[model samples]
Target chain A: EAEVAQSPRYKITEKSQAVAFWCDPISGHATLYWYRQILGQGPELLVQFQDESVVDDSQLPKDRFSAERLKGVDSTLKIQPAELGDSAMYLCASRPTGGLGYTFGSGTRLTVV
Target chain B: GQQVMQIPQYQHVQEGEDFTTYCNSSTTLSNIQWYKQRPGGHPVFLIQLVKSGEVKKQKRLTFQFGEAKKNSSLHITATQTTDVGTYFCAGPISGNQFYFGTGTSLTVIP
Candidate 1:
């Protein structure tokens, strides 16, 4: 019955403003993921966390995007000076040790105008 | 950079009909997973295929992994309105993390 939790289901910000999204993975899950989904496209991985440590972040635009998982339980994704192109759905997901299925949250939709 | 591609970017089908979508990878995939994302919703995991030439079934859904492990397929029979959503195939390249496909959005008209 555990589920991924996300906050601020909808967000609207200006091009130069800063926005932060929060995610809480399934209880006891050790792996967390963040993804960005633009309209009409598949979700793309932004960053990954494994028990407080970063496992992969090669696709993340570190210049204006930052994500952290303090204590490896809950995580946060932040974007400063968001751009118009940054308007997309931010999704958080968690994986069980089995490395099979992933449980995803409802996602946070950020619209930068 | 490894990526997955799915054909028929969009599909329109009538209720009670059959549908299928294919997923291809530029590189060998360690595992292939199928997910469903309702419009304005997050992707939900459906199934995962790991073995080469593997075939698994989940009621109306049948999944097949290519012999080369570079492709996969999902077949759904008697589709219903509840099946209306985008279907995505996601997998990871050898030694790399996961990547999702371009996605195939299916619309079932009642």
Candidate 2:
């Protein structure tokens, strides 16, 4: 089965450092999403993209967090000057069409010390 | 912002026992999706419910959408050790964003 791919299964960084996570959704999928999951909590949407265009990013921290799907395929999410509160599991999900269940990658666990 | 609520934040059951989780939304949803995430693992799509009053089933799981289009349920019959995980209900809300319920954390005793 075609699955979403994520790099850096785990990351530990000092506060105020920069970190980046990567994701590659299944082929042909046009919609991609980034989510943050705290321990014992449901995942929260951080951003959404339709093809290479951002659809929603209200939940994203614009000053420090940025994401890009330059070619409408694999995507990269970066955080500059990370904070301790940003420590969480960052999940990347995607769907072939606009309305359907999403396929999530294993995720990148970030721990900002 | 949209709010999705799920009842019984946590559930504990013995092996072979049945379990169910409920999801409610403050706003009407265009569609609802169910997902399961194992401990320290990513969420995998279980099913999707569209149209008012829709019901779908897998091998040992069943899902239902309320007639009013504001609620949904997931039932597991005779769970096993592998059934232990968090089940989340996601809904497509206004502005093409998804709102996920709090989730029901299931602990299946071995």
Give the per-residue lDDT of model 2 (tens digit) for B6-94.
98999999999999999999978878999999988889889999989999999899999999999999999999999999999999775
Worst 10 residues of 2 chain A by lDDT: A95-104
Worst 10 residues of 2 chain B by lDDT: B92-101
CA lDDT, candidate 2, residue B79: 97
**Please, what are the lDDT tens digits per residue for candidate 2 over residues A1-113?**
99999989999999999999999999999999999999888889999989999999989999999999999999999999899999999999998885478999999999999
Model 1 RMSD, rounded to 1 decimal: 1.2
Clashing pairs in 2: none
For each candidate in the order shown, give its overall lDDT on alpha carbons.
0.92, 0.92
Over A23-68, each residue of candidate 1 has an lDDT whose tens digit, in order, gives 9999999999999999999889999999899999988999999999
User: Candidate 1: lDDT over CA atoms?
Assistant: 0.92
**Top lDDT: which candidate number?**
2
Per model, state how many residue pairs clash.
0, 0
For each candidate, report what fraction of the true interface contacts it reproduces: 0.91, 0.94
Fnat of model 2, as a fraction: 0.94
